[model samples]
Target: MNVNGTLINYYFHCKRQCYFHGNRLNLEDNSENVSIGKALHEERNKCNNTEIEIENIKIDKLTKEYLIEVKKSDADVEAAKWQLLYYLKVLKNKGILRKGKLEFIEKNKTKKKILLFELTEENEKELCEITNNIKKLILQDDIPKVLNESKCKKCAYYEYCYI
Candidate 1:
């Protein structure tokens, strides 16, 4: 199975969520928050034509020097960061190289948020290791324990995990 951006993000956010995703138990369709995020992505990218799809990954935008990811919020910056980094790795494997840019449109009340990232030797190595771990975790018969229930309220798999 190909590890897409969603899996990478979910792996960072919640291992249980990642396992559920890898196992094809999708609950995002019943998620209001997920719908809003999808709408935000579609609305924001409608005017921009840089978005592209590669394998199981969807890049929000790509410029000459950067691969940009536009997010509705910065609530989970770490997950977003790793997701973007994973995209960079996929591109690198195809012989392309570019810097990573994360754009959080609704983080601060007024100011727009943007962070830049680059994949280094260390980061690439770590990501590979993480990817392997994720694959193994997802294949296990048991679901991972919830790490934080407070964060579950905003999760797409909230009901699946708690209810």
Candidate 2:
């Protein structure tokens, strides 16, 4: 499988989760958190059809100056940031360049967090390395160990890792 934005996000959040998803374990549908995230995206898209699909990646919102990614939580900003960077690289490859914007909108919170990023030559190089690493990670014979962190509790693959 090609290393997409989700895989990039998972690589930072949890290697094992990335491996499971990359290898098509497909347990996210059973997670409430995943459902809520999908619902949030659907609701926002209904309000304004800013969502766009280009090749293998789907952008939540794309404006003239920014490629915005909407997230339900900022709990894993590193993961989200890398995911957005990967998207930026994809866009840059397609001759579409824009700054990356990550918006964290919680379930009941009125205030959202916004962070902006621009893909530089330095990061783009790092992202290439990350993509290669993910490709190798998922092809391994043995699964990665469970992360055993607090974040694991909310992960969609929690059961697979813990139970």
Candidate 3:
């Protein structure tokens, strides 16, 4: 399966999540968190008709200076960042270079509301390895160990991991 933005985001947020999504065992449709996020995404995309979908990538907005990604919350900044980075990579590969702008529509007691990213050589190198790792991870016979963190409770795959 192609490693899309969701897979990249899940890989950083939770390894098991990435594995489940990569292996095509999706259960996100039942989660309230996913629903809320999708609602936010739809609302944003509705305005200006900024959503651009190409292959497996759906960018929120693409401007001369930035390729914007709108997130419902800043719950997992790293996950969002990597997802945006992957999008940047995709654009770069297509000869369309632009910086990444992450806009969090909701904040969770965090001071950060907006973040910017540029595709550095180091990040690009790491991304290459990350994609390969994800491919191998999903192909494994055994599932990844469930993370017992508090975030697991809010994850869509909570029941699969905990119950």
Candidate 4:
């Protein structure tokens, strides 16, 4: 399965949450937040930029080695970073990126920009391990428990999970 920004975000929040969101449950019926995020993404995608390859995965913006992730709130930072890191890792794996930068756009403004770098061998190993674990969870027949209360509040799956 392809890992996208949302999956990366879910993984950062909680592995079990990622598994639940990705496999055992569906949020399409109860996700105004998700709809808003998608709208924001469509807005951002309107900006034109050159493309660069990172391990057969194209970096979204290539001109300045910048990866822009638009978010509606500051709370989205961690999730955004994880997604960017994964991109960086992909670039490193393909030897396509020496360095990268992250731009977190909030409320139509640049809230934060930081340098992103290639992951080391150990980091790649850890990433593979984590990805495998997530896949295992998804393949299971039973849904994992809700691991934390904070997750419920911010989760797009909140209605399906908590109600």
lDDT of 2 by residue, 1-163 (tens): 9999999999999899999999999999999989988888899899998889998899998889999999989999999999999999999999999999999988689999999999999999999999999999999999999878998888899887788
Q: What is the lDDT of candidate 1?
A: 0.89
Question: Number of clashing pairs, model 2?
Answer: 0
RMSD of each: 1.3, 0.8, 1.8, 3.5
lDDT by residue (101-125, candidate 3, tens digit) is: 9988764545547999999999999
Among these predictions, the greatest TM-score belongs to 2
What is the TM-score of each predicted model, taking all chains together? Answer: 0.94, 0.97, 0.94, 0.73
Give the higher-lDDT candidate: 2 or 3: 2
Write down the worst ten-residue block by lDDT for model 1. 103-112
Q: Candidate 3's C-alpha lDDT?
A: 0.91
lDDT preference between candidates 1 and 2, better one: 2
Clashing pairs in 3: none
Reference-based TM-score, model 2: 0.97
lDDT of 4 at 28: 46
The prediction achieving the highest lDDT against the true structure is: 2
On a 0 to 1 TM-score scale, where does candidate 4 land against the true structure? 0.73
